[model samples]
Target: MNVAWYIWLWSDGSALQLQQPIVSTTRCDRPIEAVTAVTGGFEVRAFLFQSDQDNCGGGGVVPISYVAGVRDGWPVRVRPTYGPLATCDPQSLIVPLRPGGVVQLRVDTDDRAPIVEPAQKYDSLLVSELAVSPYLPEEQRGDWVLARAARGKELICGYVRMDQIL
Candidate 1:
């Protein structure tokens, strides 16, 4: 619930216009980069660089998008969701990712370490500390991973954590 409320009613009905800040962007320069060699229908969540300080013309920002809810609610009739992934709550603005989809990523261990910020929440961040495992193993554990992307609107980037897909 970072702030994604689109409940309006103020034209002569009183008050109900939320924060009004919905941003699900894609400019490129960092975060969202996973390409272990995926290309059978599309599965490359983010990569764009016109100059990573000076890299120049190197692009790729695929199937990765974020936002949680928007199908037909008001905000003028918002509609941007393809569904393959797109979690909710951290504000809302999801779309894209429907090329060969498979997404289920959310891990929150204990003790500490689990704060990844790329677009305020997470588009990619697993750190790989041995595949992660430490949610209060004895009392002080840690691990973290949670970008956005539910399914059909595709927003969250790279994240596996379903016991690492078994």
Candidate 2:
């Protein structure tokens, strides 16, 4: 499921430009919302159109009717598979679960699972409140565990308390 991705940015006539507009099969008009370089690669946050109909080529123009209003930006990993510094290869932020990595979520009857943004207990944004179910373990963050689950169109990646997993 490896896909070609490019972080499209409107240059001030200073940065290097790509010979060809990076096209995506899943989205159109991918403007550079944010970019952060991690250990292995960079994580890009961009507003990806949910449509595959057309490639607007970064003109910032798309058929307005096709869009369902502005959606939340998603984080895409750009690893070594990228062509050049200006280009990127899209990867999922949430690591896939390995065999025997499944765990059951423990919560009270009316309690929802708390999924936070950072690994810390303080000042972390509450990403989502998931229901009790079988969850795939992505990674461990001290007293918290990073978990991944699909809740509609977006993939939920956040930390849950270690005591919440059974």
Candidate 3:
């Protein structure tokens, strides 16, 4: 089960083309910064880069969609034999995160933390941590955060404490 993965990305969140598939590889294993499911109803994933030296930019090179399985709504697992052209840019192939954009983020805890309702008055725990977006500052609840978690296939969203995140 040795599969090579490629993350095809577009800044504007454009659709992936089937005719020509372009992709790039990255050794950088960065946690997802934010996520949103508002791209015409489809989930949009994004990663944040603090500096250009981080090599997180896709470097003007566009990526193509593949038929392989998708992970985190971005990275796709393709066959090891599949060969796509390599990028000449200095930066690793990664799409930069935009302001107010969303990407899938992970909880920085070994123990499962409680997922609470953001709109609830009392501590209404839903489930443990699964996936989350960045801390919602607009909510003005400094300790509370908006998060999405799933047991199997069903996805759930709620507010979690900021201390639970990395």
Arranged by TM-score with the best first, the candidates are 1, 2, 3
- For residue 109, give model 2's deviation from the true position in Å: 24
Q: What's the residue-level lDDT of 120 in candidate 1?
A: 32
Candidate 3 per-residue C-alpha lDDT over 19-122 given as tens digits, one digit per residue, 9 for 90 to 100: 21223223442432223333222222223333444554432123322223333342222322111122112132222212222223222111232212222222
Q: Candidate 1, which segments miss by more than 4 Å at Cα?
A: 1-12, 24-166
RMSD of 2: 15.4
Arranged by lDDT with the best first, the candidates are: 2, 1, 3
Model 2, position 58, has a per-residue lDDT of: 46
Instruction: Give the 10-residue window scoring lowest on summed lDDT in candidate 1.
Output: 70-79
For model 2, residues 19-135, the per-residue Cα lDDT tens digits are: 322333333455444445455434544444422433455423322111011102122222322111222112222233322233332111112332123232222222222222237
Model 1 residue 75 CA deviation in Å = 8.2
Global lDDT of each candidate: 0.31, 0.32, 0.30
User: Which candidate should be chosen as best, given TM-score against the real structure?
Assistant: 1
Q: What TM-score would every model get versus the actual structure?
A: 0.22, 0.20, 0.18
Q: How close is candidate 2 to the true structure, as a TM-score?
A: 0.20
Task: State in Å the error of residue 43, model 1.
Answer: 25
* Better lDDT candidate (1, 3): 1
- In Å, residue 53's CA in model 1 sits off its true spot by 3.2
